[model samples]
Target: MEPASETPTALLLIDIQKGFEHPTHWGTSRSTPSLETNVASLLSAARSYNESASQPILIIHVHHHSTSPSSLLHPSARLPGTETSAIEAADFAAPTGTEPVLTKNVNSSFIGTDLEARLRGFGAGQLVVAGLTTDHCVSTTVRMAANLHVLGDAPDGEGIFMVKDATATYSKGGFDAETVHAVHLASLDGEFAQVVSTDDILGRVFR
Candidate 1:
């Protein structure tokens, strides 16, 4: 998070919410056990970069708030009497100070939210993405970030850097958690994002 880097590559953390903690709903286990630690590392570097530079680094948090009251993500479902939503960002990834938080109901963070507009407003052309459920929100956001022209119409996700170790997903169908995670990353690699790792991004961020 040092050096007079170029226009800062914004970090987008999506759907890192409490409801995903339900193993039954997601899976018995998740793909990456180090997901929290990896994302926290990226977050720390982003904060340092923001604080050290005049041009602030944008570290945005996007949470999913399910539309249905029965859904685990909805406040009525998880909090019950308290009515507090499970949409609260995980402790390590929560927004602090001036960082922005966007609540979304769909897989893509850009849909039904001001995410794209915010990125545009901040002039954030490059983005480093990480989050829960690698195949869902994280993958969708990365694809839309390219297809929707949010990151300047790069067909091959030129501006989107998807951090592999920082993202995770659960098993579905007949597949296992690790298999699900690997397949999604492979699918999103060349077509939707430049699949990267925490150390790889940190090196570039600190460059």
Candidate 2:
């Protein structure tokens, strides 16, 4: 989907999966309550602004699921009927039909998914990303969004906006949540996209 407006914006909810509940990925390092609470807040904010026809709030949810044998989160790794494979219950409770969920395997939401098409269809130019593990899928997707012009040969412009408070990261590659979150946000803000909080963004949507 293309940006609906001259400066159209949308929100991308990335990888708020139930698999993170396991002590291995999120529980041990990132913690569930921290990630879940922030995401819930962002969802509520996005939903409220979207209600008004004047304010175009497009919400696209991105879920991560892997089928690769080498994948760290293969289905076999998870217990049957766990929230890991399905969309979290909280997400379903979002204002009905407002959020459409997209499942992906690669870190970048644009990879092997119709995300670009959906964004273009919705006419969304700027994207706000919020969800689990800021250093991995969220970080990768932001980088891709910022650099998409490379493929299309368009002039440089603000491509993505990340909600800092709404994002969470795990301890990975020798970096803990504090270090990873800070470094990634610094690189993303200005360079890749604007970084804002759920409250600040909520104000814009409502006002």
Candidate 3:
């Protein structure tokens, strides 16, 4: 299951921050109990592939920071003393210094960021996306990535993939989090992106 593009591919991690992990603040059940472990595994594989690949695999980290002080995601709301928003180090598979970190204020990473241009600049024709909130930020970013016309080509299915096991969202209203996660995965599969497990990605796509 190698990606369709011969050009370099990127591992795009979206919104894997600490604020989302707070059960009291975020209030969501995960699709998998091993979400952090799976994400770490996939990230390790991506790093290994990047080191060996001649085409240069880029690892990009996308995080969300609330622009408004009133927003729950605002650093002031989460940690009073910290002026900067940070990825939750306890849970995050930390990125190397060479990897670029992109911050976004909106659900779609591309809306206020240069992520699309940066990917194109790196000659990345395909992307594997993994991160928090399967039905929100992760889903939104994957859809935008799928729609991107890289190298003068039309939007295609090969452009992006969603790592199912590596992402989780909180349950909302009466719907369970697992159900929400599954429904979004189903919607994206065969359309915006291929929904795949971390093992599938590591064994097939990254290998």
Candidate 4:
């Protein structure tokens, strides 16, 4: 994956939380059965690449926290396996000290967080985005990332590469999850970002 420039790149993981994994609470019908596995593999490769590369990759996690007490994702609500809005253990490995987790309440990770500033601070002009609900948080954040102008005059000129297989969405309103996932990817492809697979990311971008 050739970057737009030599600027540092970051792997932005969005809303890969346990709250979305609770079958009974969140319902079934996912875009891919191997979504978590693919995400974990990508995360591992990104971390490894950061360690060995001359320009380290910044790994940032965007976590969602609902404020309403009745919401399933409310921080106080407990899932079957975890007590908080923690990253899903089944699909994601534990994060290290170097990685920072940014919390947000809305769909876009950039809305209430310093993510844009942080990316600029790290000198990251390219973003590798992956996460849950391909049609929701993933799509919103990517669009914002592509349009973000940290320097004030023009858009930050960031290049966003989305991992297709590493993201999943739930079936909704009689539509299948797979179709929803594909439609969203199609909409984003060649527009907000380039949609690619985990294998493509590992082989081309991570190296």
Q: Scored by CA lDDT, what does every candidate get?
A: 0.81, 0.66, 0.75, 0.76
In model 1, how large is the Cα lDDT of residue 8? 50
Better of 2 and 4 by TM-score: 4
Residues forming the 10-long window of minimal summed lDDT in candidate 2: 149-158
Can you give the lDDT of residue 159 in candidate 4? 62
**What does the lDDT read for residue 1 in candidate 4?**
49
What lDDT does model 3 reach? 0.75
Give lDDT: candidate 1, residue 73.
Answer: 81
Segments in model 3 whose C-alpha atoms lie over 4 Å from true places: 3-7, 70-72, 79-90, 150-155
Tens digit per residue, CA lDDT, model 2, 44-126: 76566556646476778877777775443554554345445433433432435646878788899899888888777766656
Question: Please, what are the lDDT tens digits per residue for candidate 3 over residues 1-207?
Answer: 464235567888888776665564566465667789988987887777777676766788887888877665665555434544444433555677888888788899998889988888887766888888788899888877777654237356565778888888877877888898889899999878878888877776676
Off by over 4 Å in 4: 3-7, 81-91, 149-158
Query: Which tens-of-lDDT digit does each residue in 41-136 have in candidate 4?
Result: 878887777776878788898888877777666777677665554334334645677789898888899999999889888877567888877988
Best candidate according to TM-score: 1
Q: How many residue pairs clash in all the candidates, one count each?
A: 0, 15, 1, 1
Tell me how candidate 1 scores on lDDT. Answer: 0.81
Residue pairs of candidate 1 with colliding backbone atoms: none
Error of 1 at 143 (Å): 1.0
* Number of colliding residue pairs in model 4: 1
Model 2 residue runs over 4 Å out of place are 1-7, 31-34, 69-72, 76-98, 150-159
TM-score of 4: 0.88
lDDT for position 12 in model 1: 90
Model 4 / residue 69 / CA error / Å: 1.8
